[model samples]
Target: MLLNNLNNDQGFRNFYMNKRGPIINHLCFDDDVILFSSGNRKSLKRIMRTLKTYEDVSGQLVNKHKSSVILHDKACARRIDRAKRITTMKQECFPINYLGCPLYLGRKRISTFSVTVQKILNKIRGWFFKFLSVGGKSVLIKHVLQAMPSHLLAVMQPPKTVFEIIENAFNRFLWSGSDGNKKLHWSSWDNLSYPINDGGANFRKLADISKAFTTKHWWKLRTKRYLWSLFLNTKYCSRIHPVTNKWRNGQSHNWKAMCSIKVLVENNLGWIIEKGEVAFWYDNWTDLGPLYKFLDPDSKPSKLRITDAYQNGHWNWPACGYVVSDFIKAHIERMQVVLSDKPDLPIWKITSSGKFNIESAWNFLRNSRHESNIVNALCHKAVPFKMSFMAWRVFHRKIPSNDIIISWFKLLASPNCTCCRVSQPENIDHIFFQSYVASSA
Candidate 1:
């Protein structure tokens, strides 16, 4: 088959070369065809007839529907109707589907062509998904659902209860996992981790409590009668009030805090001791002895004092200052410090006089080598900011490439790409040149 294809390609090339004088370029890939020529309409018609004859002899009929003929000029190539041929010479416009994209003829700019191409491609994709089965339909639905507005999604309310939500999510999973007509095995609700029988009593109790809480009578009783209302409200509280011995305050006091700690010890011992391996720390405290033993072996009175000092505040002290942009600035600062100290470094140097413009300093360092050591150092430090200005200077300084201007306009127009939601400094390679799945726009 490979030999046959090679011979066929050679034969076609030779035939076009020998017989067609006006044929400038021709390309064929398997059954697909693209032919270029610098001939008048009469000559092109003659060539087409000859090709048809050859196809008839070779038992490969030409798909005129898929074939096209355009005059050799940028305007003609741009104006040619790829989908439907122009029957009249006066017709200035035609429609074509180039590379699975519908394009209107007579578009003067390449940018417009690209936009039209993308639109048609998306339309084709929509059509393809529409023709698919229930499972495929569900996938498209999921995609659409993800793209929907958050407010609209909330209002839709597909599932109200936890059980209903779980059931709906499982149904979606089942549909996605199997193809059409293939059955999915679902165990009885009894076989679930929390069986319906066990959950029923809890659910009913919760429903009754919720009903009582939201009732007009409960609200009136709490508001109309002051002392009785305070007492009734006190029963709902989890914290013991300072003035009243009853649990009456909204905030969690020492007693409630201890209760929470007890619950954590009872419920999360496996997580703390085995998974986190905090048994060393757990052993020191009697109530939470196992957890303390796993967490810290030497957790005596002295170590507890240090731990209390560190854990006094709600948030961790070390992590409090570590914002996303701080990481980038820290990396840049570290690279600058390292490069300034190195006397013989090719891509960096500290002037006898200190100048503090970041861009200028970067340029001076970049001028010393093809590979920017400062930028490389920043990369080593795991900084997310790309050396975009340097890349722009290399690619767009000499030749005024509109691609670069378009890129700049795009970046300036929006900090984030429309498709992938990644923020700038995004390059053309990251946006369009790479795989579409990975591309930002």
Candidate 2:
């Protein structure tokens, strides 16, 4: 309603988008208002007046101090000063932190994402992570440490170095502890990244989480009528199909990040082939996977459709030039295609219901290669965290027994069993099983 009044005002003008696009003067969510302007002094005054009027009508105060008027870098000094005076808000530059996310132009830099790293550090600096056991650290990593940077990861693809820094912090906190003392890590971070059911500490990689977020955004863009989706579609792919559109080199950081996960999306995105609009080689309508994958990686893909391969209601692979093995060919040959009036729609292949969900997307994108293991039982609520850590240490042969310490430290000491009269090496096996005292106990 405020925007409508602003548009009607003779002094107001919108930011120049493409010639054929939505008339987006400004957009707001909650108290966050992202205003677009043509940088006219009269226009800025009009916008403030409109805001003031809206506040009067809706009983919502428009705090000028909380708002900002950001102008293009090339704008003249006079325009900048005029904007500052008109809005009475802070004058800031690009690469600024807006609502906890960086709004930057061109390539995103490390400095642009420094706030997230700082936030993560601030969240953990007060806690004594070194005093915590493996179980305690595991819980903190999942529920606290990892969750800190998730908001930033979902929106921005920070540099590889940033991810490494955050990961290094996680490694130090979990293995070496917060005291900064070096310690032997009993398990590799990769192993620790798996879920408790899969015998890991559940310290997931933020990189994977970022990919899941990108995939979620892609799914929304393709399937939903969201505001951001509409804006992005208008700006980048107004005419072309969202899935098939080839990304130009000049695009934003998030767009490139979204493009980087195309293969992951294709693997799980199925088609509801109705009008047969899905590409024959590019799409996965046949359920055997993208036919393009079966072809040579360097082969120039020929443009075709699902309807092209069918003649008189029968599947023919050779007719489509998709030279797959007889097994794959036979699989597609037996499959039936039912043509309908509706267009092809994308579906999440992970579930039968055809709805895209974050959990399914995360599981698929994370590429869980885990199997059931002892960690499941060890992670029970009744078991103590330290005891669980001890059991894991014993299982991995990392316990500081006499034989282990002597052999591991490259120093010779008494190798005989200390628990019994039986003169046997005090190894993990003997200490736990072979010794008479151990067996009797």
Q: Judged by lDDT, which candidate is best?
A: 2
**Per-candidate RMSD, Å:** 36.9, 4.9
Model 1 C-alpha lDDT per residue in residues 222-320, reported as the tens digit of each score: 224454344433443224221122332453232233232232222222211112111212222123223222323443311121123223322232432
lDDT of each: 0.32, 0.75
User: How many clashes show up per model?
Assistant: 20, 0
TM-score (C-alpha) between model 2 and the true structure: 0.79
lDDT of 2 by residue, 1-441 (tens): 877667677778778567666677877778787888887878888888888888889998977677677888898999888888878888888988877888888776888889888888776666654476767777787898888877877777788888888887777667765575767765666666765566655568777888889989887776666878877878777765455566788877777877778777877888877888677876777787777777786764566777887766777667787576788767776766688889778889898798887777777778576544665677654777667657666766777788778877888788887667768788889887888877888
